[model samples]
Target chain A: MGLLLTEDEKMLQESAAGFFADKAPVSQIRALRDDRDATGYSKELWLEMSEMGFTGVLVDAENGGFDMGFMAAGLIAEQMGKNLSASPFLSSSVLAATALKMAGDKQAAKLLPEIVSGKMVMALAVDEGGKHNPDAIQMTASPSGNGFKLNGKKSMVVDGHMADQIIVVAQTDDGLTLFVVPTDAKGLDTERTIMVDSRNAARMVFEDVEVTGEQVLGEVGKGADILNTVLNAGRAVLAAEMLGAASQVFQTTNDYLKERKQFGKIIGEFQALQHRMAHLYCELELARTSVLTALTALDKNPKSAGPFVSMAKAKLGSVAKLAALESVQLHGGMGMTDELDIGLYLKRIRVAQELLGDADYHIAQITK
Target chain B: MSDLEQFRAETCAWLGANCPEEMRTPMKRETDGCWGGRNWVFQSEAQKLWLERMAAKGWTAPSWPKQYGGAGLSRAEDKILKQEMKRINARPPLLSFGIWMLGPALLKFGTEAQKMRFLPEICRGEIRWCQGYSEPNAGSDLASLATKCEDKGDHFLVNGSKVWTSYADEADWIFCLVRTDNTGKKHHGISFILFDMETEGVSTKPIKLISGRSPFCETFFENVKVPKENLVGERDKGWTIAKYLLTHEREMIGDSGNLKPVAQMVAELGIIPDAALQAKITELTIDEWAFSQTMSRMLAEAKAGASLGAKSSMLKYYGTELNKRRYEVMMDAAGYDGLEWESERSNDGELARLWLRTKGNSIEGGTSEIQLNIIAKHILELPGT
Candidate 1:
């Protein structure tokens, strides 16, 4: 499956859609909002999903995975978007696996196989502050007597609670550094945080955690270099996923309009309603095109992916947010209900948007 | 390479190897038609040769269906062919409204007989089409036009004056809007009609411009008989057809934006290459990229079967403005040469004609003001003027 998916992908997406509809429905997500310890999604279905290659989508076939690259892995996320499925793929594969690839170390490579097997959980603990911007780093990493002592809180860590390993971002005297700390390591504290999306993220406290000097993921002070490249790829995948999510919101609202009647006719029959739907549809398609072009451009000009990456993030991020908001507003009172699937989309969109730099942040970076 | 990739590579190689050699120039090279716009003189052998070759290959209408004399390539394939053609610096097969506007309309709304008849001829470069729109008073308020088309039972007698009719004097045929009902509201009475330019009562006088080019014409039709079969769609419903045709026309103008801006190209390929000029070129390329994305999105959305109503106006407005900006830059790149009106001394003939003639781009088809109103009413839901 490439920029335009093949027919088999459409069928695969349909099958995934069927699984989500039958098992981990919206009600399950709704019930998990207040339960501090409640992690939603069915484990049996997750195993089934893992069997379907949801776990190691971009992993090499040699690692007991499908070697479909970002494009195919991206489509699954997009379809997962259809139901606002709160899977760990975004945190583990797109973020952590991406960082590992950047480090290109023997340890990171060895960890990939384990991570892909769905037997291990991992997270890239970047973003020292609430900001997703790399420039926001204030965490300190300094040489201790034998190795290194890391001190700083990594805020808004996805899977930070359940992650077996946290790839923490810290600043050294040289520059920004990324360190892989085992979640069980002493002096590390993880506290659960509530998210609008019902997915659990955590605020992590790292107080003088000692690690070997070799525990750093890549070359010292070069974490920003890897972050930019990984984020570029992330931006494209995020765009594809957002496109998928926005598409569902558009569809759900459309379905509701068709089902609910006003003035003795379907509200969709009104020209005013039709034009608003049409305009939003146009924006979604435009965002989709920008994403496809960005991906194609990335394949061609791997060197200049920075601007295009930011462009995709800037365009698709704001557009997806708008799609979610508009879908709810257009749906009227029922759209905001926890029962409807549209609310799930809005919830997930808000969180994922903040996961990356928010729209305005990315847009400001894009002005260059 | 995969078969499709191999096919694409081979196709590009072939186009690169076969594009006409002598026609490649940074200077003004004449076409079969020379006088520009209304008085266009077909004088260049290379232009004629290029057109015949492309039309025969069906590359002229790549996205169009093969049954209607098009290449009928898939969207991806069509995009590849277009990129290859650009890489080869191929001059357009035909830049006429016939290929871009009327042909697409005929394919969509034309009777099967019309498609079988006109599309092949259009594809083969056997027809020359000119738009018969715009009038002195009806320039921006196009729907308020008072041109008359009386139904004479056997045929419709068209009598009116169309101003700024590009290439009306040189064109073989004209597609126009004329009033078939006078008493109804201004917009409802108008009907879109097509007729032969050589009809006895039809004549055109060139409207010369400061650029020594005549892109506009004053067309007068007196009792010109157009066959009833030439009536596109319904008579009173011509507004619908005209509006639909306008979308295709706006899109046509928008799609034309994929070309490198004349000034940008000159800055890169002309005798003078400088850093400041190259920066401008980068800017234009970005605009072109954004515009290309917009047009591509339109096609993709349509293919995906989503209804995209009225956004064509937005495309038209941005595109026409971009085109004007492109031409302005072309004039800037031309420097002192832009002031030279004599065709014999023209630096880049196409560039010269384009720079001067493109002034009407914002004015032609639908005016920029009309587009603003469209966006206001149809898109923004603003109160009517």
Candidate 2:
């Protein structure tokens, strides 16, 4: 009923949605999913998207980025949702940029320009096993002379292989610290563990990773705190994208309902189905508002992410699942089959459910 | 200077100087929260005086022009006024459908005479108005109303029943949409008419809900003659006026920033709620703030004569859902309190009553379902039957 987006946001959404609709469609995703490399997105699409400013969405314009912040990144993710675009918009653009911004690192200045310019890619290898809580890190780093030696592996790293650098979260005696490691660094072994969507995976394995003191992303033993903040920002943007996926699927389901006749009338005409679609539509809109609020709240720092992401993850994670499940269930067997893109949306939603954390994890965070 | 700053300064200073301690707690009828207290009368003399005083100055209807019985405040000024009032938790001076619903319609569609006659009473809070639109069969499919409005040339006969009328038993007047032409399409052939509830054959039977207190009523019209002069707009054009009023209804559903869901939330989640929950509560409170800000912004846009079509649905959806969330929080907090279904508990901690009342929000003012249909079809370009 309203264009909750700003005028600039509207323009940004249009341009972004247009880019994904034209540049990244379902067939390309299907091909990527089936390939041995499981390369979800190609370099060409990445470069083209970089030209459109998808990579450095939150980066300042002078740094070859959009400077549009989390909202713009979210707009891109939303468009990506429509195409199930397997890109590093979430990992490199949003999560990585937030990390650099939080670290007060102008080095991201030298690095982000290349990343924003699509010449380099970065992924925050933040997630560890058992629970997705950043504070629950088991990975370790030790003081070795003037620099730190890292002996830890971050699994479920998005675009882990495609990244030029993986920001590793490690625990130190001092506290938690984040260190940037080159993808081809001596001790780093990247075996892309396949995801259901194939294009995205858990890049697992670690050796004695040596890095200079200068390689530390932030204060020693404080990376967990920093990563938590970054993920909250990521979660907000993730919600917007979740909303985009839900919205598109709702439209798809609505179209299917109208076109597919049943019980002597189009299914859309049935009050029962109409109410269900409408309910899903409400859920999507709720998620949309909640995400927007969280995006606006991200700069509040420590107090910000703790509550905002909890709300986002709890609401969006569950809401996205509902929308995805409803989209498929309401579509009948065709939605379940690989014949349509609906099933792919569901798989990706599953990945998002695990992206930052799941429903239970977020609920626990909020409760805690 | 920002109108908000000026307005807040002015309002605070005035209240500080003029607000009486007795008026601060505007005496309200004590009752179970669901069915608002009828036995309890407002005790604050300052409230009555301020309301009357504000009505004379047209300040209560802050955005309306002084020419049409309002304070003629700018959008920013209105925000400041509301914020200042909220800062004091000032009891609402005017609370009735007349202020929220009918005034907007009269401003839009009423004749000069109609405005002169009705608007002032609305401002003075002398007359209470209720809506009569829903029919037994036409609850959601409202256009299929069977309310007959046959023209007698001098007057129109309004004979039918409107169910689920909010406070109709207490209303002085009702604005109704009745089928004026049976031959036309179902959506067409309707005329908008206003009539006095005290008129012959006009009666109300209050429906006692599961919650105990009866808020809604079954309003029936038996050969009630509404003067042709009382017809709003043209004949068979009640649908237009009715649709216009529905926007106000939907907007009302959305704009509840004054109501705090925090207390209810605390009551619902149990465990007295620690700092973490407080932090979450703060986030929710901020969301409510943002939502209200957006509503005020939309109000400004509308005042500036910008077309704000489906945005009303946006407001309604958020408002109603927030309300539901408030109830959920309450129920959660109540834990055992919410589960008590005894008739005796209906007035007390009364979880059953609260739950019953919560169900009413979704059903009224076009169910959440209908609101979505409007949004999807109009806002998102989704197909609807």
Candidate 3:
């Protein structure tokens, strides 16, 4: 429980890393930004990932899944982050799959196959506008005949415009509830929210968006329980990705420090800069261990996943942010340019810091 | 069913039968356990008996060879014994730098005669050891030490001083590094040697630390003679052994940071209602837990024969940082009472003193900055000018 990674797990990580390195590189990430790709990622690479069994990693084997745990998905996310591959893997393959599987309802059965096959993109519309506090949820689901009518906006809905289905968290008479709504449903408005990271998300305004009784995820008034669990999974995956990004950023900066000569010598020769890089390296190791421990904790005790996830998020978010800042600062003028890939990591890290929950938000949740 | 299980059961049975009830409770003060040596005094007969019983069974150095008065258990079996002891809440039978730091080096590099001579005494708690690596001018740059040792054919004349030698005034022997040849590279011309603390001209002066305790000393060797046979490995090759032993020293220092839960500390301090303090406690606790997991992962990797190399620097740096945070939060939880000095209400300011003591944890066993340099050069492979 405390030690070595089994051979199977190691192989799973190796294959994913190899796949990302071969199929998705930083050049491809830059191309997407330069072309202003509407989807913000490649559909062909998504299918290849699905074919590699990554999309179904968390689903039951009976439902076209390999049944690998969140740790496996975390490994995939880590590799994808190294290449800065932008995709719905986090939104659809990880968070959505976790929500559906944890719910274990009829909708999961109906949608699991499509989601696993990469035919359907999914996003979770949970927060209203403020920070990622679950208690700030005020989107209402009012009674309208046989189903509920959804109103209020959900901001920063990751991959919302590209999604065919969106799981919206709304307040109803039964308290917080989750509903699976079709993206193109009546009175639904989706505005593409261009982010600093050049990633795709949408601000969704749900005006009388109707859903049937069967669309409800889990029991009424109990969506918070499922939402928390899904959010823990999201946080863990995010931590893994951040670790990868921080590690890459550290390596990139180290290379720059070695190559960039200043005053007739390499900048890496400077003791102050070396010490700073070393500090960042230690922080990266801490974040790495915290992320792995969080993933293991989730598998060991699903009920007690909150503190571990929060801890991982709090530590990794801070580390990733520091790594991004330090990497940019270490790379000097070249790092400030958009043409350099290091800026891309910095922007992505900044956005990811605020996603799921920022470090401060998570510290509040766990500490208080 | 398994051999380890059988060993665990036997260990449990023996400990239950032998460990005194008073010794089963938590150590309330630093002086609760026996640090065996010539100057050692047992806190109680139970403490003395406990060390005697454990030493008789050669469990003091459980993983050492049986011929050296050790149990000769495998690493897994040794771990089981530790778990069994912890399950019973049994206090450690003994703690000594001899057993922790020097024993491993001796086992690896000592001649057969030297191992037979020194290790059994360490196992039976008959001798105590102190390190002589750091000098005033050579704390982080330890190889630049000016402890000069001249070749006198059968013996060497040692003349120099070592600063920050913990418990040097009470030690039975000193494992020292001295400059054997100043003509070569600072690292190359050094040698590791051992000598009795009672040797003529050897003297110690205790240095009061910020904690107001004199646990460390300034040890001077004025033409003290150490036998040539006491020289470890080859002459002028002690830097390798010094670095090897430093890895263990760093590990030993880091491993002492197993504090109780922060909630338990709050309960003890009687401040369960303050949200600000609670938040600090929670944050520090999470970091400690993460650090523990990392340490365990590293331990497992070490057990699998994977060398940690420069990663030990990472462990030392983070472990000390976490330890400092632990005490800081404890002080914060203790409030005004934590700041009391030399008062009965504050255990004579024990908490405050210990909190200041942790500042030394980063400085000793190589400063955190030195560790960072090692990490940068070795682990991260950052090139130098």
Question: Of the candidates shown, which would achieve the greatest DockQ relative to the real structure?
Answer: 3
- DockQ-wise, the better of 1 and 2 is 2
Candidate 3 docking band: medium
Q: What is the TM-score of chain B alone in each candidate?
A: 0.83, 0.86, 0.97
- Candidate 3 lDDT at B35 equals 79
lDDT of 1 by residue, B1-385 (tens): 8867986997787676655664344234323332223344445766666666766778777777887778887777877887777666666656667777788667667788778877776776667788776777787777878778998999999888989887787788888888899787877877777888988899999998755677669999888999998987678667776777788777666555456555446755364735555445445544555566777656665664233467777677667777888777667777877666556656535566766667777767787666655654575443332
Instruction: Estimate every model's Cα lDDT from 0 to 1.
Output: 0.71, 0.75, 0.87
Tens digits of per-residue lDDT for model 1, A241-334? 7877898888777666666777677676555665566556656655766676676555555457666666666667777898899899988998
DockQ of predicted model 1: 0.09
lDDT of 3 by residue, A1-368 (tens): 63467788899989988999899888887888789988989999999989999999888987888888978888888998888888899899888988899889889999999989999999999988767877898899998888899999998899998899999999999899999999999999999987888888999998988888889988888998888889999989988888888889889899888888889988898889999998888777768788888888888876798898999999988899999999889888988998788999998888888999998888788866
What local lDDT score does residue A64 receive in model 2, on the 0 to 100 scale?
73
Candidate 2 per-residue lDDT, tens place, A138-232, comes to 77788888887777667788888678888888888988888888888887788777778656655656677788888988787777777877888
TM-score of each: 0.72, 0.87, 0.97
DockQ of each: 0.09, 0.22, 0.67
Candidate 3 structure quality by residue, lDDT tens digits, B272-370 = 647767677767767777777777777877755344778888888888877888888888778789999888988889889989999899999999999
In terms of lDDT, the best-performing candidate is: 3
| Model 3 local distance difference test score | 0.87
Question: Interface RMSD for every prediction, one decimal?
Answer: 8.2, 5.2, 1.7
| Model 2 ranges off by over 4 Å | A1-4, A60-66, A105-110, A299-306, B22-42, B135-138, B144-153, B156-161, B220-225, B262-325, B335-352, B368-385
